[model samples]
Target: MTNMTFSEQIWYGLFKPSKYKELVESRKSRSVLYILVILLVLGLVTFVVPTAAIITGFGGMNKLFSETMAPVAYDGNQLTIEEPFRMNVADTVFILDSTYYTVPDKELERDGTYIAVGSKNVRMTTIIGGEKWMDNITPIEQVLAPGFSNDSLVDMVPAIYVSLFLCYLIMCLLYFVKYGFLALILSFIINSMNKQMEIGLSFGQVYMVCFYGMSLGMLLTNFNIAMGLISPMLVSTVTVFVSMNFITMAMVSMRKGNQV
Candidate 1:
């Protein structure tokens, strides 16, 4: 229509070739305006929720849920208590029947460091068990980290979450720069085909897609499926992909005032 062949007029789009074909064949709106708006919004959605933010949010959510749905029971005065117990996240907890290694010198050093003269029933928890750790592990088989076994599991979650948060953020930043909007658009279309989203969205509509999209791809793969259970990053990435394309294409078609 613009003095160019159909193929020539159609070169590259945010959508992949397959997605572009589907988008072209379908009745939709296509608008090229608001590139900045799309970028800003999608950037926020995908980037704003850092892994730390996510963990914090999850912690807050856990707090709220615990407070709201805690068990109710009778108190000493026959009164009702909504919660029977309080939950706290800890890294590691050790309840050894007895000390395997004897404590020397009643005067404890300013630092908490204690010398391990010999083996003892010292229940310990570590973050990551390594080769050296295995040698002195109480459970032997339960050697968490040779050099990094968590002394307490309860105390480690937040720290672990923090480390994960940092990695998660780094990956997000790296991918955001590497992929940017185009990658987001293409990813959006693919996820749409997978039915990850009911409708497509625009990069502007769901900010932070670039950061989160890559974050998820890397995080989930590392975690296998444990993180996947409650990972919104993956879900957002998928929704961002499928929904954005439909949304962008729809917007474009609307601008043209014509049917594909």
Candidate 2:
């Protein structure tokens, strides 16, 4: 090996992954921990604020959904969710073809399709069917675009859009740093099954485990922030049962897959 400066050597080796257990437990890895905290705060704040505002502004939007709409089967795209509770959910307003925003860099709309005008302290807008509507409130979800609501992406306004992008990028990057190739593969498998995963899923099936774990937690997120973090741990309690029998079950499952 040719002699190189410490910086040069460290730069080249940076691309290579270090041992997992080491990094996983390193106190120096607080960047990812901080990122998780920021994203959680951003997501929870974004969700609760607009939800609270919508409830305050339109009053019944939350009740309408939790009491009425939720009871209806959710067909997702087939349904146009115009409730006040989800004004921050993307595609629920405005119009974007993208599935979801990149977390920290959610692009609202551009050009004439969706535009913003005037000074209600607003900066985004759009024109459709000869009618002009403004929408700058970047959605937490962006599905039912083109309609305006009391939950317009403009509520708390700038703080939501700008901060969300930063928080989202950090969360995504941190997700990659924490979840390696095996976790990625497992995630894909879990994503294939259902909307969420529980904690007791197999190590090979950690995807589903984490998915539903997050999902269940998302629902109860209205609870205290600290509790919200711990709530997902409930899935871990189920791990003992899964471990007791899953090894033999996994071997049999693999044999069955091999036969196919």
Candidate 3:
């Protein structure tokens, strides 16, 4: 810690957690730096990586939408699709008119996303992702000639970007809260062990170690996922146990036989 810079300590904490005691002793600023670096790493792994994958997988969603989804004529009162078509749910848009009707697209019912045009109240259902959103649409001020407009599909990019960003931000905060809570519990255990060993380390020091220790657990969980060795349902539980174990190992390595 005396010789290493703040950025160096961050790398050390991730790869060499045994140096945590020395790192924690130098300056409280190290704690803040470590936290910011950890969060940045987590954000890159969880958000940035997935976002890149999605962008690559879609291969220009706007272009795809423009080429595919187009408005088709339907009864003003109702639009029904009984067959699967290339222009399925994502491409289908029901234009609102004087007639209030029901849409029953068998293809959409099986798997698709349908949009009700000219109304703020719209039902968006995705069969594959198993997500449903209902809202009164208020954006379209005029009724078009009762057909799908590729421009409408292309125009949705900004809203989708905003929604995705908000969701990512919320998820990051939730993860921080969850990880911090678990780290605090692990810190309590380390504090008790410190007392037993006659070590004088404070709870703050142990808590910082717990947070840094979490990086190892997060990395391991990511590795296990990439290797397809663990199920998504078990990741949180496994992460907690793994992170706690890392903290325990750090405590033992950093202080042995009353050496703090």
Candidate 4:
């Protein structure tokens, strides 16, 4: 195990759970920390392309607004635009028509539906469960804060990036908590069963085994998320199942003295 390169360690961690016994016995305690850091870094890497696309999308929207949007003003009561504006991006339609007080029924039936800015309020319509759902009408004055203008949209780009970073941090924290909880549970189970064999593994050692065993599951979870292939709950369930299976195999190998 000491002779194994990092890539070989990862390969064994994913494909050969029996090798985890050697990892648990021969590796330093910090090996678990190293695995955790690697997993977290992989998680962060999965978000890079999506985050970049979001920022670029915002930039494009700002450019579109700057170039095409007419000068608009809002008083305490009504919103006034120099001309009625309408734009459709993909399936969603944005309309700034002061004459219409509500989103038209036809617009609400489409996939992405409509967000209509009327003189007094903004109305949004969404389709859920094959039914049209109208969002609460927001007053124009409430929607447009005082001193807020279209120019402020560009200023929000930095804040958007900051928000994305915070979200990524929060996600990493959740992953850490989730993985730790799984490791603790597996360690307890392994220790309880080990009483029969008298293998005498400590909680920390079992935890290290479990963490190392989780390599493949974590990678698959990240891949599924990046590809948007499954629901979050399904992905989580599969990860838990895979990690537990790998950890069980590792514990069995440890008991058999196969790879120690």
Instruction: For candidate 3, write residues 6-92 as lDDT tens digits.
Output: 777878677666677786676887687777666656655666566656555556558655553344233333332232124221113
Clashing pairs in 3: 71-147, 71-148, 119-137, 120-136, 120-137, 120-138, 121-135, 121-136, 121-137, 122-135
Question: What is candidate 4's local distance difference test score?
Answer: 0.69
- Per-model tally of clashing residue pairs: 61, 27, 10, 0
How do the candidates rank by TM-score, highest first? Answer: 3, 4, 2, 1
Q: What tens digits encode model 4's per-residue C-alpha lDDT throughout 149-260?
A: 4676567756755765775666677677877787778777777766667777777777777777776777777777666788967987988888878877777777787852
Question: Which has the better lDDT: candidate 3, or candidate 4?
Answer: 4
Q: lDDT values of the candidates?
A: 0.36, 0.35, 0.59, 0.69
Each candidate's TM vs. the true structure?
A: 0.23, 0.23, 0.64, 0.61
Better of 2 and 3 by TM-score: 3
By summed lDDT, the worst window of 10 consecutive residues in model 4 runs over 49-58
What's the lDDT for candidate 2? 0.35
User: lDDT, candidate 2, residue 171?
Assistant: 43
List the candidate 2 regions with Cα displacement exceeding 4 Å. Answer: 1-156, 181-232, 239-251, 256-260
lDDT of 1 by residue, 39-129 (tens): 3333334334433354365465444334333332222222122322222222112121212232223322222222221122223222232
The clash tally of candidate 4 reads 0
Candidate 3 error regions (>4 Å): 68-148, 222-242, 257-260
**C-alpha RMSD between model 3 and the true structure:** 6.9
